[model samples]
Target: MMALAVDLALALVAAAAALSFWRLLIGPSAPDRILALDTLYINTIALLILLGLRLDSALYFEAALLIAVIGFVGTLALCKYLLRGDIIE
Candidate 1:
C-alpha cells in the first residue's frame, strides 16, 4: 500500500511537471513563462523528496532543499527584473 501511494503521488507530480513544461514553452507573456518555470521548480523539488523517501536516502532530500532555495531566488530575481526592468543596476 505504501508503494502504491508513492507511485500515485509521483504520478501526480509528473503530471504537474509536464503541464508546467508546456506552459513554459507556450506561455504568451514573459511573466507567464517565469511562473511556469517556478511551478516546474516546485514540482521538481517535490519529486526529489518523494524519490528520497522511496529510496530511504536523505541526500535527495538535501538536494531538493537546495533546489527549492535556488528556485525561489531565481523567481525573485525574474520578478524583480520584470517589474523594474533591471536585474543588477
Candidate 2:
C-alpha cells in the first residue's frame, strides 16, 4: 500500500536524521563536523518532504525548500571560513 510505503520512508528518513545528528555531535574534526552538518541539513529536508507526503500538505515542502536554501548558504559559509579562517574578506 502507498500508505505503508510512506510510513516506512518516514521511519527511515528519521533514522537517517538521527544518525546525521550523532555524527554532527561526535565528528573528530571541524571539516568532519561541517560535512556532518551538511548531511544533517539534507536529512532534515528529506524528512520534511516525507512528512509532507505523509500528511498530504504542501507547507512541509515549502519549508523544506527554505531550509535547503539556508542550509546551502550556511554550509558554504562554514567551508569558506574553514578554508580562509574567515567567512568574509
Candidate 3:
C-alpha cells in the first residue's frame, strides 16, 4: 500500500535524522561536524517535504525550501570561516 510505503519512508528519514544528530553532537573533527550538520539539514528538508506529501498540503514544502537555502548558506559561511578564519572579511 502507498500508506505503508510512506510510513516506511518517514521512519527511515527519522532514523537518518537521529543518526545525523548523533554525529553532529560527537563528531571527531570539525569537518565531520560540518558534514553531519549538512546531512541533518538535508534530511530535515526531506522530512518536511515527506510530511507535506503525507498531509496533502503545500505549506511545509515552502518551509523546506527556505530551510534548504538557509542551510546551504549556513554551511557555506561555516566553511568560509574554517578556511579563512572569517565569514566576512
Q: Residue-wise lDDT of candidate 3 within 33-58, one digit each (tens)?
A: 99999999999998998898888899
Worst 10 residues of 3 by lDDT: 1-10
The residue-level lDDT of candidate 3 at 85 comes to: 94
How do the residues 1-89 of candidate 2 rate in per-residue lDDT, one tens digit apiece? Answer: 88899899989988998888898889889999999989989998998888888888999988999999999999999999989999988
Worst 10 residues of 1 by lDDT: 53-62
Positional deviation of 88 in candidate 3, in angstroms? 1.3
User: CA lDDT, every prediction?
Assistant: 0.94, 0.90, 0.93
Off by over 4 Å in 3: none
Total clashes for model 1: 0
Q: By lDDT, highest first, what's the ranking?
A: 1, 3, 2
| Per-residue lDDT over 1-89 for candidate 1, one digit per residue giving the tens place of the 0 to 100 score | 88888889999999999999999999989999999999999999999989988887889978988999999999999999999999886
- TM-score on alpha carbons, each prediction: 0.93, 0.94, 0.94
Model 2 stretches astray by more than 4 angstroms = none
Ordered by TM-score, highest first, the candidates read 3, 2, 1
Root-mean-square deviation per candidate: 1.0, 0.9, 0.9
